[model samples]
Target: MLYKLNLEHILFLDIETVPQKPNFADLDENTQMMWEQKSQYQRKDEFTPEEFYERAGIWAEFGKIICISVGYFTSKGDSRNFRVTSFYGEELELLKQFKQLLQEHFNQTRHLLCAHNGKEFDFPYIARRMVINGMNLPYKLDLFGKKPWDVPHLDTMELWKFGDYKHFTSLKLLAHVLGIPSPKEDMDGSMVKGVFYEEDDLDRIVSYCELDVVTTAQVFLKLRNEELLSEEEIKKV
Candidate 1:
């Protein structure tokens, strides 16, 4: 079934997010209370809400997307090129730009949005943040009433599960097991918050996000029994 799909129609992506505020104290009193309540189970006396705040990005209500990097394929005869690009800076603006890209170019029924753990994390995180920012959901991201099979999204982690709903696989583990190059050589998701809030290095995050996008595309190709992308075949634009 994977072989039947057109690779050109799929937009592979990854995102980086950080807490909405630089510090836990930056949130208003009511919001801070809400955060404590929301993260209670996860915190479980192991850490205070302020101490656990570094992981707030995992929850859309308390986080904002800082980067969204995408990659897609183009082929002509025997030659193929994978072009990568990113949208970053100012959460609302980046979301708008990403929405425009989906609505303008990838709006057709045949087009798809693919990410590593997108169905669980990336996809819903983007949708929730869009709503929080007062932006209408784009067609691809709006899945309110669509049937499961009708959705135009692909998840590498879900694909690897192969109906084992209990299975969970991280992108780094999947890439390593599948022999795709590691995207976490420089930094992993754990370091994103510090990079964004303390170091203010969005460029580094964007690069890491793009690497995940490229690695995701490579993983998809591997799933389809297709050739892995050579470094020369990947272009950043």
Candidate 2:
């Protein structure tokens, strides 16, 4: 069990992304053509690439990360609290701040980045976006020639799969099944585009992203058969 891996060494995180542009029509000629080719494989005949562009956020090449929320555990006496912080706003500023946080605190080999499906989605997405932004890769996000055992990325969803690559589970579903509190009351990834573009509510999106980071941590504890964090034990930083 991962309980053997000290919780204090792990930084749990989640990110919110939206299409790089407000809409498909806003893409430059080269990007538009690239998107069209990419969407063809994922969308059906009834959906034009423009209509399907709403899903572009899931693809690192076509999306911009609007927020990245991270949480880590700190112990005080017999109590352990999870402190979460977030970076928001424009993509470059958001990436810079997040990178600074990693470089400052979680840069060491012993610190791990844990997310629900981090290795596949969150980790790679952040790495790809950082390169596109002309930034050097942070140690945790870089895997140029890393041996599998050397990587410090912990993926809760991948853990739950128990080597069953055939099945994929959502963090929400895992939380419910594990008897942890649900984090889905307000909105989900599908609604992120509208929240960011139409509503212009980065605050709302940040709140949602924070919930995912906390929930991912909770799920990890559940998998380890450890007590879930009480509400009072969660802090915002």
Candidate 3:
């Protein structure tokens, strides 16, 4: 089914997020208590709220998107290329920048967002963050009454599922099995919180995020039995 679609119409993307505060203690008393209740089932008795706070980024309520990398395909005659770009810095500012890109360029019925596990994580997380930050919902990100078929969103992980509905596949593992290079050389999700707080190196995170976008696009191409983009073909815009 993916092979039948025009690749140029899809926007490949990936995002990185972290807890708003470095640690649970940095939050106010009420927020701390709220987190405890929210995370009780996930944390159980093995870890306290403070210790479980490290996993806060998984929840949009406790997290903020630090970086969003987006990519789209362009064609010149028979040759096709993919361009990747990123917005990273202050959370709200970066979100605004990304939203601007969407509104100015990729906002159209033919344009669809493609990401790994985007429907479950990336898409909703971005929408929730936008609302939380007092931003308007973009056409593609908004999910009012639009039926499942109407949503202009595509996910590589969901595609890979093939209706299994019982197993999970990591992006790195998919890339490996599909013969695409792994995007885990820099820092995996577990290490992102520490790197963002302790290392103060958003650049590293940005690079990692962009690789994910590129890898995700490659994964989609592979699924459709299409040619993968060469290194020289992927320009950073």
Candidate 4:
């Protein structure tokens, strides 16, 4: 079934997020209480809400997207290229730009949004943040009444699971196991919060996000038993 789909119809993407505030104290009293309640199970007695705040970006209610990097395939005769681009800075503005890209270019019954673990994390996170920012959901992100087969989204992690629902795979680990190049040469997801809040390095995060997008595309190609994308075939636009 994967071979039946055109690679050009898929938009591969990855996102980087950070907590809404630099510090736990930066949140209002009510929001802080909400955070404590929301994260209690995960925190247990090992860490306080403040200590667990760095991981708040994992949830849409307490976090904001810092960057969304996307890559799509293009073919010219026998040559194929993957062009990558990113939207970053000012959460609302970037979300608007990403929505515009989906609505204008990728709005079709066949177009798919592909990411690693996208259905569980990236897709819903983007949708929730768009609603929080007062923007209407784009068609691709809006999955209100669509049947499971009608929805056009692909998840590498889900694909890797096959029939095993209990299996969980991180993009980095999957890439390594699949023989795809690692996207975590500089930093991993655990370091994203410090990079954003303390070092103020949006460019670094964008680069990492783009690499993940590229790696995701490569992983998809591998899953389909197709030729892996050479480094020269990837272009940052």
Find the candidate with the highest lDDT and give its number: 4
Q: Quote the lDDT for 208 in model 1.
A: 91
What are the lDDT figures for the candidates, one per model? Answer: 0.94, 0.92, 0.91, 0.95
| Local error of candidate 1 at residue 25 (angstroms) | 1.3
Name the regions of candidate 3 deviating beyond 4 angstroms: none
Better of 3 and 4 by lDDT: 4
User: Candidate 3, after superposition: displacement of residue 126 in Å?
Assistant: 0.4
- TM-score of each candidate? 0.98, 0.97, 0.97, 0.98
Q: Which stretches of model 2 miss by more than 4 angstroms?
A: none
Task: Kindly give the stretch of ten consecutive residues in candidate 4 with the minimal lDDT sum.
Answer: 180-189
Scored by lDDT, model 4 comes in at 0.95
List, residue by residue over 1-237, the lDDT tens digit for candidate 2: 476888998999999999988899998989889998988978968699999999999999999899999999999799899999999998899899999989999888889999998999999999999999999999989898999999989999999999999879999999989999875458888999999999999999999999999999999998888899999999999
Off by over 4 Å in 1: none
Across 19-127, the per-residue lDDT of candidate 3 in tens digits comes to: 9899888999999999999999998999999999999998999999999999999999987889999998888898899888889888989889999999999999999
| lDDT, ranked from best to worst | 4, 1, 2, 3
Model 1: lDDT to the true structure: 0.94
